[model samples]
Target: MNIKITGSGSYIPNRIVANADFAQHVFLDEKGAPLTYSNEVVADKFRQITGIDERRYVESDLVTSDIAFFAAQRAIEDANIDPETLDYIIFAHNFGNVKAGAIQGDLVPSLAARVKHSLRIKNPKCVAYDILFGCPGWLEGVIQAQSYIKSGMAKRCLVIGAETLSRVVDPHDRDSMIYSDGAGASIIEGTDDEGGILAHETASYTYDEAYLLFFGNSYNKDHDEDIRYIKMYGRKIYEFALNRVPQAMKECLETSGIDIKDVTKILIHQANEKMDEAIVNRFYKLHDMVTPERVMPMSIHKLGNSSVATIPTLYDLMLKGQLDDQVLTKGDIVLFASVGAGMNINAIVYKI
Candidate 1:
């Protein structure tokens, strides 16, 4: 039997934050000194590199679990499956529910449990849990669900990736412009039909790259050291991903036994526009061919980077015919890949 993603859903928050919104804000360097460039110059340079004109944010009353539930509810409906039949509910996220103005993440009960509770799934057989594998968390959750199906432990599963990064960003750090809130979910199950997941690969580069992306005190320096926000060495991460993600994708496609020519689409993590272009360009170079036109679909131009939610949200939008000129038909072979905070990378080859 093949493992297939039967249905999918995503929640892109309604609050749109444009690049121009940062005009009056103070952006500081790590040394607590102000950047020499004016706010317009800083935001413009950021757009040139990251290609983010705006991003979404959750309303003041919402949290990560709230959005996760919204996405899960839609996935269940899309699959037209009864919630009680689900054998597992796997949720992926970095920071848990960080309330408005809160400095801490609330993770007493797993986000999976909270979502299952919100979905009102009454079956006692449904096991729920959460995974923290950085930006690749949702794809990693899909990999885990495949394991359960292959091991006879589960036949149907709900995998979700969601985050409310707006609550965890440092206003003084320019990198804060790259994060936003969103959620995406899928229903995966064992199937006798043709299309399904074919192969997957993962890697961890923890020697020195572990701190490439980490939590740190605000750039303002006046913020308490005990109170930290998401921080990263942007240059280091771009270099690390360039050197690793493309190779990982090649190995995964090879393991699936699909020729490079048969691959139809590439759904990569939406971290930066320039970085993704470089990685895809390098992947084609490795295969000794030029990149194909319209093979990759992107949401970062408007949605920014929602970590684990990027790929799923992009896929959802594609299926709904929201992305112009990007389409996937039956028998299409697609590659799903991401690189993020563990300094981690993962890729999967799937037949649609």
Candidate 2:
């Protein structure tokens, strides 16, 4: 059996957070003094470094599951499938729903369960669960759904990746600028057709690098002592992505017996604009093919890194012709890749 995405949808928060928004929230020193820097200077540096002008943030009352619900509705409508027919709801996220003004909290019933309820899905047999694979979580969920379809355990699956990174980010931390909130979803069903999810690869290198990106409270005496936030060694992650991601993508394409030149688009994790560009270029270089200027599409400038939500949301946008000069047609070969907090890397090949 083959697995194909029948429909897709995404929901980005209405709240637009420009780089200038960070100016007022800069971190303070140990003595309660503001860090010596102008917001304009920092904003310009962010643009030059990450190519991000602004990102979205959910309102105080919104949570991860809520955004996922919105995306799911759009996806199901696009697929034109009955909610009762869904056999599985696979949700992917690192931080679950956090209460307004709370730094640490999670959905007690699991995000998948919450989404199922929000959709008013009444089928008791539909298995709903969550997967935690860092940024690769959504792709991993799709992989699991494919396996279920192939084994005849399921006929249709809903895969969702959603996050509210702003809730868990340390406002004082520079990395805060790179995190955002959004959701994306895909409705995948079993098919007898030849083109779908062709081949894939996944990997983890968490032995010593598990802490490269981690969640912990700030130790600064002037900051909130009990609030949890994400922290990372930026240089280490940059080096890891530049070195590992391209090789993994190359191997995945090879496994599918697809030539680099045949690929139509490369939808990579919106981690860093420069890093994603370099990874795609490196993959094509391995095959002695010049990187096509339009081969890779990016939404990071507007969405930042919503962790698992990045790839699928970008994919949805491209499929809908919302991304400038990017579109997908029948029989087009597409590639998906992501890497993040789990010290994880993964890629998938699909035929549209």
lDDT (tens digit, per residue) of candidate 2 on 255-330: 9999888999999999888878888888887888889878888899988889999999999998899988888888
On residues 275-303, what C-alpha lDDT tens digit does candidate 1 reach at each position? 99999999989999999998888889999
Candidate 1 residue runs with Cα over 4 Å from true position: none
Worst 10 residues of 2 by lDDT: 26-35
Q: Which pairs of residues clash in candidate 2, taking residues 3 or more apart in a chain or in different chains?
A: none
* Candidate 1: worst-modelled 10 consecutive residues by lDDT: 320-329
Regions more than 4 Å wrong, model 2: 28-36
TM-score of 1: 0.99
- TM-score, one value per model: 0.99, 0.96
> Using alpha carbons, what is the TM-score of model 2?
0.96
Best by TM-score: 1
Tell me the deviation in Å of residue 149 in model 2.
0.6
